[model samples]
Target: MSVVKMKLNGKAVSGDVEARTLLVDFIRQYQGMTGTHVGCDTSQCGACVVHVNGKAIKSCTTLAVACEGAEVTTVEGLAKGGDLHAMQAAFKEHHGLQCGFCTPGMIMSAIDIVKRNGKNVSEDVIRRELSGNICRCTGYHNIVKAVQAGAANM
Candidate 1:
């Protein structure tokens, strides 16, 4: 076994994992956090999205050891002092979610989108950028609205 260490959600954490352990597994199993979903084992879905060093990436395809010493942020890390992150709140306010399975990844990906595209991101840009995230519910109309509102608040 190898020791992997990283700053997760602003807190330093370390865990023993094999070289083949995926970041999603490490987050859900070793770290005991289940907010990061595993919609598909493959990278086709963005449900396993997480922030590594302040950038969004698919955790299901990333090795846990590859993120050693990196700053990783899962969906669970977005809240602080019992308040939801702007994106999460926006999702709730805009009814961006239905089943809630894809909500976490959508919020994380949306935050990253705003970080790269700025607060005034367009609907087309949001739809294009979120292509990797597959949402079977809600048809993305409200999700786009939530992302824009969240970006403005962020």
Candidate 2:
């Protein structure tokens, strides 16, 4: 086992993990943060998306050992003082989620999109950028609206 240490959601965290352990596995199984879902192991589904060093990445495709000393932020880190993040609040107000399986990843990716594209993100741009995240429900219409609204708030 390899000992990996990193800043998780603004807190220092360390755990022993196998060399082959995925970052998602380390976060969910070892760190006990289940907000990062594993909808697809193939990395096609963005359910395991998280912020690594302030950038969004598919956790399933990333290795835990590779993230040593990195700053990781899961869905659970979005909220502060029991209040939802702007993106999260927008999702709720806009009904962006249905089954909720893809909500976490969607939120994480949306935040990154807004950060990169700025608050005035266009609908076409949001759609194009969200190609990686797939939501079986809501057909992405509400999700797009939520992202736009969340972007404005952020």
User: Per-candidate TM vs. native?
Assistant: 0.98, 0.99
TM-score of 2: 0.99
Measured by lDDT, the strongest candidate is 2
Scored by lDDT, model 1 comes in at: 0.94
Model 2 lDDT per residue over 1-154, tens place: 9899999999999999999999999999999999999998898989999999999999999999999999999999999998999999999999999999999999999999999999999999999999999998779999999999999999
Error of 2 at 23 (Å): 0.3
For all predictions, the C-alpha RMSD in Å is 0.7, 0.5
Clashing pairs in 1: none
Query: Per the 3 Å backbone cut-off, how many clashing residue pairs does candidate 2 have?
Result: 0
